[model samples]
Target: MGGHFQGARERPNGPRQRDGECSRGAGRNRQIHRGLCSPSQFSTPRVECTPTRETPIARRCPDAPMRVAGQPQARSTVKSTVFVVVLVFSLIATGADAQRGPDTLGKIKAAKSINVAFSGDSLPFSYVGEGNKPAGYSIDLCQRVIAGIGQAVGEANLKVNWIVGTAAERVQMVATGKADMECANTTMTQTRLKDVDFSNLIFVDGGGFLVTVDAPINRFTDLNGKKIAVIKGTTTEVRLNAAMKARLVNAQVTTINDGSEGIALLTTGAVDAFAGDKIKLIGLAAQAKDPNKFAMLMEDLSYEPYAFALPRGDAAMRLEVNRALTKVYVSGDIEGIFAQWLGKLGRPSGLLAAMYLLNAIPE
Candidate 1:
């Protein structure tokens, strides 16, 4: 239930792009559905859902008898209430599906390479590693996905074209078939699912405040009037705003391009606090020139589930990615990855690992 997500801002080079942008399908502008893109608009263009039986209908009926035609008699009444509930729930589910991006798997296959988009800045999850190559948990997971594709196509060396992008462009890359997969710290939210598909939950993240060691704020409720730093187009922004609104708290929000810029602002005292995912904040803090100057508040505001994103139509691709993640979780590779990248502060507990294991599948 914890993760990171990027933004929706345009890149400097006109709009951020990968290999090439695909055309947008109708009803493709809604928020994500079920933590992925709309099923109708597949970023991969290679997947389709064949309907199957769902949960059994819960049935109820009126207990009271009514007189009809001037006669008192017991009559069986099939209540319309059940239908109403079903209709309402179905609409919710359908609305979620409508948010998914169109199928793009066919387009991706024709293009030959399975293009993957990722945030070039989210280190240890998706970032520039040695040789300026994309490396992190998501990157490694994608490598396994590439292996699956090689097995499918009988190409041992299936090529993976890595495209560096921002949070704003991640979905568009998949939605338009510019890239077939997204390997960033993406959160699973209903709004994002409408535009692209997400793989299994790769990591769990919680929202917290990042502040200078000397700052006075120590709790989620303490962010009043204080300029809080946040990234644009991310769940951190959405949830922080929502929490503030719900709690009747007010704070000035400053949107930055990346964590580095955000830390710069904090270091210069341009803002009172930096708000983001705890893991990411810790990463930034560890790499800071003087790590002792900042600390993450222990109190959390929300939990988010991070997952890999793909175009909605590519169920095969989604499944393949999920399978690889499952292997990582079951094989204990995820633990190792966390240790290598995030375990310095503290090793993830049995509870957190159990949660990851239980909800390993994509929503």
Candidate 2:
């Protein structure tokens, strides 16, 4: 009972109890005085003083007497003073508990695990590397994030659970409590906000097409009545449909589970075009059998702002993620990450660079 709250009868206007140990009574009193006082009321005072004269305590037992030293000073007043002191202590204790941060970090520390989700196929963002382990820009960034989380939570050796899945499943995993973080290339969109929360925009990308360099498809309008390969549950899927419809192109969409599948279909002439974010197309092109065979369509159909997704209710996790992103953005580390994974194309324009600098959180 070291961390226990005060008893019921000791709480102001709480229900009368035989021994005043009702926690429900304290809860009711707390609800009533939710904004009535501050959290410091129960703290031990720095100064101490003795009463010069004892007065009769109000609303107390008549038999009780107040004594300052060996001599009796006042009788009834002592009981009232004791009740007031107990009430003040209870209020302060309750407020302190209410202000305490959530134990998410503590839970991770105790369990020695940090679960995360990564897109299994989004190259340069998140994908399998050597030994089939997770790698890519987001994967690297998340490794640093996990390190920061471990340091902050005092779990330096925490085990990591790297869940690999499609982009669609990545968001659902984190949103449904199956994973703590989705270090995938999840775009920050209004629709995703319904079930998931996003950290600040970590990377920016645009929906573009990757077609054979000699193919007839030069822009969005050139793919009329063409077979377009796209990954399901991505902004590129939507953009493909929208652009096709707007340009009066009769496009047949083939939704693949991974980038390699899409590229394979395209290479075999099964699909007339492959649609994805420009950054992803670049990464995929680098891995293709013939890197020089394909080219990204200059016309971007849509913009996708990439971010890390966390569970909706975990505000502390969200804050830490934002802190990490803001740190990299301000420190100009993103340029290095971009260069490492995306080469020169990943560099943002002057406007976006200024935005990142402006929104960076100060330590």
TM-score of 1: 0.68
List TM-score per model, in order.
0.68, 0.70
| Candidate 2 clashing pairs, residues 3+ apart or interchain | 56-77, 57-76, 57-77, 65-75, 66-74
Tens digits of per-residue lDDT, candidate 1, 17-122, equal 2222222233323322122233454555422222232211121113323222312122112234455567779988998887653544445555566788887778
Positional deviation of 51 in candidate 1, in angstroms? 68
Candidate achieving the largest TM-score: 2
lDDT for predicted candidate 2 compared with the true structure: 0.75
Model 2: how far residue 158 lies from native, Å:
1.8
How much is 306 displaced in model 1, in angstroms?
0.5
Candidate 2 ranges beyond 4 A from true positions: 1-106
